[model samples]
Target: MLFSLIAFLGLIAGLLYLATGARPLKWWRPDTLVAHDLRTLPYMLSYPFEAPDSRQNIIFDSASAAASSPSSTTPAPATQNSAGAAAAAAGGVATPPNTPPSASRAGSHAQLVSTPSSASIGTELPGIRAASLDKLVQRLTHHSISDANFAANFLMTYRAFSTPAELLEKLIHRYHVPLTPSSGRGAATYDKDFVHPIQVRVCNVVKLWVKTGYRDFVNNPTLIARLKYFVALMRRTGHEALADAVIKSFDKQAAKFAADEAAAARLAAGQVVSPASGPSSPASSQPGTPRPGTPVAGLPASAPSTPAHGSLATAVAASPAAPTSATSSPAILKTPVSRAMNAHIPSRSPSKEEIIASPIPMMPPSDLVADITSFLNKKQGSATDRMSRYTAMLCSDSLDALEIARQITLVDYELFRAVEPVECLEQAWSKKDKLTRAPNVLAFIKRFNDLSLLVVSCIVLTPDIKARALVLRKFMLIAQALRELQNFNSLVSIVAAMNSSPIHRLRKTMELVPEKVRQQFKAIEDLVGASSNYKQYRTRLHNLDPPCIPYIGVYLSDLTFIEDGNSSKVEGLTNFDKYRRVASVVREIMQYQDTRYNLVAIPAVIKLFSPDVSDELGINEDKAYENSLLCEPRAAS
Candidate 1:
C-alpha cells in the first residue's frame, strides 16, 4: 500500500515536471507526505450500543426534534438498529444516510475481562442473548435498595480484633432477607449486584443440573455458573447511612475487640524485651533509627503532616528483620515489587501466619518476616506510641515512598490473605485473645489506616476538609464490615448498612478491580492525579454510583471541610478520559430504560468536551457535534 501511494505521488510529480517545469517531487518530503496522509485519512466511528426499539436510538440523535411531528407519519414501532433509520422515518423525517455512531472508545489501563467467554461455556448467554452485557447486569438498585449506616463501630475491619471470623460466620449462619427476584422481563430489565438477572437465575439452575449436581451434560454450557464467585463480592461505599443488616452492639463489640488486641500486643512487648533493659540489640535492630516513640512536644497539634504515618517508621525500625527465606513472600505475590513491598509495612492487626495467605495475599508487607521480628524484638514502647513516634519522624510532606508503603500495607489487611506467619500484622484469632486486646491498640491501628488514607484522598479529590471528613466517616464503616469477612459464607448478604456517604455508593466499582490497577491508583495517587479536569467527570459518576473512589472519597470529603476558606486557582478540565468513561456508563443507563434517569431524560446526547479535546479529536466544533471518533468497542463493556 505504501509503495503504491509513493508511485502514484511520483507519477503526479512527473506530470507536473513535464507540464509546469517543476524540477522534483519536493511535495513528497517525508514530513509533507506524513502530514498529507493524516489530513486525508477517513474519519473513524463506532456504535457500541443499540436500543431495543429503534425509536430510542432516534431520540438520542435528536430525531424527535428533527422530524417535528410524530403523529403525522408515525409508523408502527420497529426493531432497533445502529443506523436507526426506521425511528427517524416513523416521525416523518427522512433518515440521514449516515447517523453519528455512538461508539465505545478505549478505557484507561484496559485489562482482560476475567469471566468465562460464551465459547468456553459451550453456548450463548442464556435468557439474555441480548448482545449487550447490560442484559446480564444485576438490578439491585431499586428504590428499596438502601445502605444502612454501620461506619461508626469498627473503623477498619468489621470484626477488628475479634478472634472468630464473626462476619463470615454470620453469613454462614444467617439468612439474607430475600430480594425481589427477576420479573420475567426481557434482557432489557436488570442490573449487576445482589439482585440476579432472569438469565443468570435460569443458567444457575441449568449449571447445577449439568455441571455440578447431575454431571450429565457432554460439555458445560451454562455461563452463569462459570461467572466467578467474585461477582458476588459487591460493596456499597457511597451510602454510609444504609445498614442492610444492622448489628445491635457494634461499638461495644468493637471496643471489646480492640481492648483484647492492645493487651496482647502489650504482652508481646513485655515478653519480647523488658522496658528496664530496653531492646536486646537496639543499635543492631534500628540501623537508621528516627527517634523511636520520642515526643516532639513543642510542635503544634497539626504538626505531623507526613504523607504516610506509620509504615515507614516501622520499616526504618524493622530494617534488621528483613525476612531471609524467599518463601516469606507469598506465592501469589509473584511480582518482584510485591516481594519488595514487605519492606515498609506499617500496621497489620492482631497477628497470624496463614491468615495473610488467603484471597488477597501479601498486603502492607513490612521489610519481611525477619524485619517484623527484629522490630518487635527491639521495640520497648506501646504500639500506638511507636506509631505516633513514627508519625512525628516522617518527612513533613507526602512522597511516592509514603503512598506506596501505605498502599502495600493496606493491601494486606484490606485484601491479601497471608499464608505464612506475619506476627507483625496478622493474628490467629482464638476465643481467648479476642477477649484480651487493648482497646487503645485497635484505635491506633484503625486510625493509622484512616489517616494514611486521608492524606492520599487529598491527592485524588477536592482538597476541601469537610467533604473529606464526611467521606472518611463513611469509609470507616465499610472497613468495619470487611473486618468480619473471614467468616464470609454464601448464605449471608454482604451489604454494608448503606450510609448516605457518597463514597459508599461507589465501592463495588473500586473493590474488585484487578490487583495491579488497585495498587497503582490508590488513595494517594487519586488525591494527586485526580486533577480539576477529572472532577466533573467523577462527580457525574459519584452521583450515578458513589464508590468510584470510595477510599479517597473519604479523605477528599474531609479536605473539603477543612479548606472552605482557602483560595486556589482551580483549573478547568478538557481531557476526554473521564468523559469517555462517563459516556460508557450512560450507555449502561440506556440498556435498562427503567433506570432512575431513563433514556428519555437525555434531552440531547451532547458530546461534551472543552476546546482542548477538539484538537486531539481532529475536528472543529461543527463537525465534531455530528461525529464521534472511535476505534474499538467491547462486547462485554
Candidate 2:
C-alpha cells in the first residue's frame, strides 16, 4: 500500500512536469541558450583571469560577432555608420581596434542602429528599444503583419513625434540606399533580384501614407511638391501602380477640399445649402426643379420652404441676426402712440397659416426644452394609460437593446456630423456666444447630457426592484451595443449615468443584477474610466474604423491643453507648431465625420427619441435623485 501511494504521487508529479512543459527544471538546465543564459555561460567557459563584467562582455561579444560577419549581411550606409559611431562614443563604449566603427556599434549603443539583419527584418522585436531613423524606416517598410500594424499607428500619430519633412527625408534616404552588388557580381542580376523587393516596400509605404494621411501633404505645399517628386521617382523605377495610387489619393483629397471651399463660399453668401442636395440629389438629377429653400420667382419671398431640422439651417440661424433699423419699420410703428397700442394687444399663438407665411430664419429650434412637457399631457391620455404604455415599451421583455442603441447612434451621429471643424478650432462651443458660434456643437452636448439624465431617470423611476434591475440590465446591454457600434459619445454618456450617485447607491437593486452583467458593466467602466487620462478609451478609439462617434470631450480637452500650454508666438515667430498640433486634432475629428452610418432609421424607434417625448419623460438630474430616494430610502445613520 505504501509503495502504491508513492507511485501514485510520482505519476502526479510527472503529469505536472509535462503540463508545465518542464519549465522549472529547464530554468536550472536550459535546453538552449537564451539572453539570460549568456550572462553566465561566457564566464563559465572562460579562465578566471579572463572573466569580465557580464553586461559589458555581452556588448563586446556582439560587436565582435558583427565585425567577423561583415560579408554575411549588407553593409550599412556611411551616414548610418557615422551616426552609430557617435552613439557609441556618447555611451562611453570604446570602439575596438581592427573592427569598423559601425561594427563596434552594437544594437545596445545606438546613435542610429544600422538596417536590421535580414533574419530580423520580418520578425517581431523581442522588446521595444530606442531605434534610429534608419531602423524606423526599415520597420515601416517591412513586409509583415506586425510591421504593418506598427506602420499604421506610426503614420497616424507621427505628427506628434516627427515632422512631415523629416519623415519624408528618411523615406527618400531609404529609397536611395545603394543596391550595387559586390565586385564581379552582375549589376542587372542584383538590381532585378535583390533590389526589387526593397524598392517595392518603400513605394508601398509611401502609397499608404498618401492614402491614409494625405492631409499631411494637402496642408503643406512643400510636402506636396516633395511627394510629387517622389511619385515621379517611383514611376521612373517601374512602380506604376503604387505611384498612381499616391497621385490618385492626392487628387481625391484636392477635390474634397475644393467641394468644402465651395460650400463655405455658398454659406458665406447667405445661400441655404441642403444636406440632401448633394451632387447626386434629386434636385440635381432633374435640373428643372428648384432646390428646396431656394426662392422661386413666382412664390412670395416669405413663402420659401423651410429646410429639414439639424441641417445647415441651424448654423445659419445661430449667426447674429441683422439689427432692425428704426428707419426700416413703418413710421406709425415707430411712434410712441403705436408702441403703446402694441403693448396693450394680447399675445396669441400663431395660426398655421400665419406660422407658414412668416419668414422663418434658418436656425435650430428656438425652444431648448423637448416637446414632451409632462406625464400629464392631455394628448398622451390618462396617467395610468401613459404609465402602461411606458412600461410596455421600456420595461417590457421585448425590448431590443441593440436596436435601441442603433437608433440612439443614428440620432447622435447626425448631431455629431453636423459639427464643423471651424467650431472646434475656434473653441466656440465653450464660448458664451456658443449659440451663435457653434450651434451644432452645443446641440451635440445637449443631446449627450439629455441621454445621460434619461438613463438615470429610467433606472431610478422604476418602482419595483426587479423592474429596476431589468432596466439597469437593459441599459448595460445598450452600453455594450454602443461600444460595439463604436459610438463612444453615447457609450460614455450611458456609462456616466450608470455610475452617477443616484443609480450607484442602489445597493439592493445592484445586487439583483446578474453576475455576467456585473462583469460586463465592470469592463465597460474600465473602458470609459478616467484613470490614466482615459488611456484605455483612447487606445480603443484609435483602433476603430469610421462611422464612429468619438467622445468630443476628449478632443475638447486636447484643444484646451494646446491652447493653454503653448504661446501663440515664440521668440517673435508665429508658433506654427501650436497651430499644427491643433490642426492635427481637428483633422481627426473631421475624419470620422465624412463616414455616415448605413443603419436604417426606424420611425417608431425615432419617435421615442422625439425631443417632446424625451422632455416629457422628465429627464432631470434633480428628479433622478429624488426618484432614487423614493425607490430605496437612505440607511439609518
Candidate 3:
C-alpha cells in the first residue's frame, strides 16, 4: 500500500512538470536543436582559467564541431563572422599581423557600425518569442471580432521578438493576409460583397485593428511608425480599405495633435493663441466654409512658424514620407472647439420652419417652485393612470424632444454665459459672488435637481411593480432618445432621476424590469458614470451629429477643475493661455444658442418633469432601504 501511494505521488509530480513545460517541450521537440542549445548553456559554460595543457582543453574543437554539425540546421546570426569579412572586403585591406582587430583604427569599422540595416537592427535585439508572437499574429484574423481585436491590441501592447514597430512591420510585410476588392480600382465592393472567405476575414481584421488600436497608435511613437509604415505597404499591396482605415484614424489624431501643439507653443511663448486657432465647429461655419489656413473672423493666426519639440511637428517630422495633404498646415485645423465635438451644421441653412425653439418657459426659482407645487396639487389620476400619461410623455415625438433639448441648451447657455469660470473655483470667489453674478446659473441647476427629485418620487410612490417597471423602462427609453438627439441636458436630468436613491433602491420593482431594459439602462448608466472622468459620455457626445444638447455638467466641471488647479497668472503676467483654453470651451457652449431647432409643445412631459410636492417627501437613504426590504423581503435560507 505504501509503495502504491509513493508511485501515485511520483506520477502526480511528473504530470505537474509536464504541464508546466508543455510549451517548452513543444518548442524543443526531438528534431529541434534550438531549445537543446538554449537548455545546454548552463552546462556549457567555459572554465574561468585556461586549461593547464592543450590536450586538457575543455572547449570543443571548432573545425570538428563545424564539420559534425548538420548542414540543414541553421547557425545563429550571432555566431556568424560576416561583419569582419564584410569590413575587410569593403576596405580591400587585410589586417596587419601585429594589430588586433579591435585595436585597428579603420574607417570601415565606423562606417559599418554607424548605419544599420532593418534586418540587423531587429536581429541584434532580444525580441519576442516567435512561438507566441506568431500565434498572436495568426489569431489577428480570428472569426470573432472581439478575438481579432484582442489579438491586435495584445500584439502592440506586449513587447516580444522585436520592438512594436518592427513586429508590426513584420505583420504587414511578411504575414499580412491580403484582402481582395471585388472590382479593381473602383469603389470598394468589399463592404457589400459576402464572398471571398480569406479576403473578408482580412478586411474585418484590419477594420477592427484600426478601430480599436488607433488611440494607441496615435499616442505611441513606435505604434505611429508602425501604422504609417504599414499603411503604405498595405496600399501598395492593393488593400485599399485597410490603408484608408489607417489614414482616416491617423488623420484624426494627427490633426488634433497638430492643433494642440500649435496652441501650446503659442501659449508657452507668451503669445495669445487666437481662438481662431481652435477647431471650428461645422455648426458655426459661415455660408462659405473658411479656406484652410485662413484665420477665423475676430481671431488672428498667432502660432509661430517654428513648432516646439514634443509637438505634432515632431510627430509629422518622424514620418516625412507621409503625404503633405495628410499632414496639412496645422493652422488650417485649428479652432476654439474640439474637432471631434464639432457640431454637424446643416449643409444648407436651417429652413425657417425648422427654427422653432423649445416652448418650456424659463422661470425664476421661486416661480418654478410655485408652478411645480400647483401642478402637483392639480394632478388627478391613479398611479396606473399617471404611468399612462408618463408613457405618452416618454413617447413624445423625437423631433419635439430634440426641440425641447435645444430650448434647454438655449436657457443653459443664457444662464451660464455671464458666470466666469473663476467664480466656480473654490477660494477664487465666494458662493455669494457666484450667486450675485449669475443667478440664472443657480436657478438652472436647482430646477434640474428638483425635476430629478420629482421623477424619483413619482416612480417610488407608484405601488404596483409592473406599473413602476413600465414607468422606469419608459424613462430609460426617453433618456436614450435624448442621448441620440444630443440633448444631454434632458438626458442628464432623466438619468439622474432614474439613478436617484429612491428609484434605484426599489428592489422588487427593479426585478420586474425586462432583461433587455436592464441592459439598456446599464449601458446608459455606464455612459454617465464618473469612470475615466465620463470618457464614455464624451466619446458619445463627440460622435453624435450636431443639433445636439451639450451636457452642461461636464463643461461646468471642466471649468471648475481648470480654475481650481491653475493660477490666473504666471510670472506676474496675465496668463492669457489659461483664459484662452477656458474661453474656447465657453464659446463652444455659447454657440449652441444659435441652433435653429426649437422644442414643440409636449405639455405632459414638461409637467411630469416639473418639481412637485413630492419634493417634500424627504426620502432619505435609510427610508429607501426600508421601503426596498418591505417590497421584496430576503428569503431565509
Q: Identify the leading candidate in terms of lDDT.
A: 2
Best TM-score among the predictions, by candidate number: 2
lDDT to native, each model: 0.23, 0.51, 0.40
lDDT of 1 at 346: 13
What is the lDDT ranking, best to worst? 2, 3, 1
TM-scores, in order shown? Answer: 0.20, 0.45, 0.38
Q: RMSD of model 3, in Å?
A: 26.5
Better of 1 and 3 by lDDT: 3
Which candidate would rank higher by lDDT, 2 or 3? 2
Which residue segments of model 2 deviate by more than 4 Å? 1-378, 381-388, 571-573
TM-score, prediction 2:
0.45
Taking the tens digit of each residue's C-alpha lDDT, what string does model 2 give over 510-580? 88989899899799899988776677776666655455789988778777776666654443333333444
Cα RMSD of all models vs. native, in order, equals: 32.1, 27.8, 26.5
- Candidate 2 worst ten-residue window by lDDT: 331-340
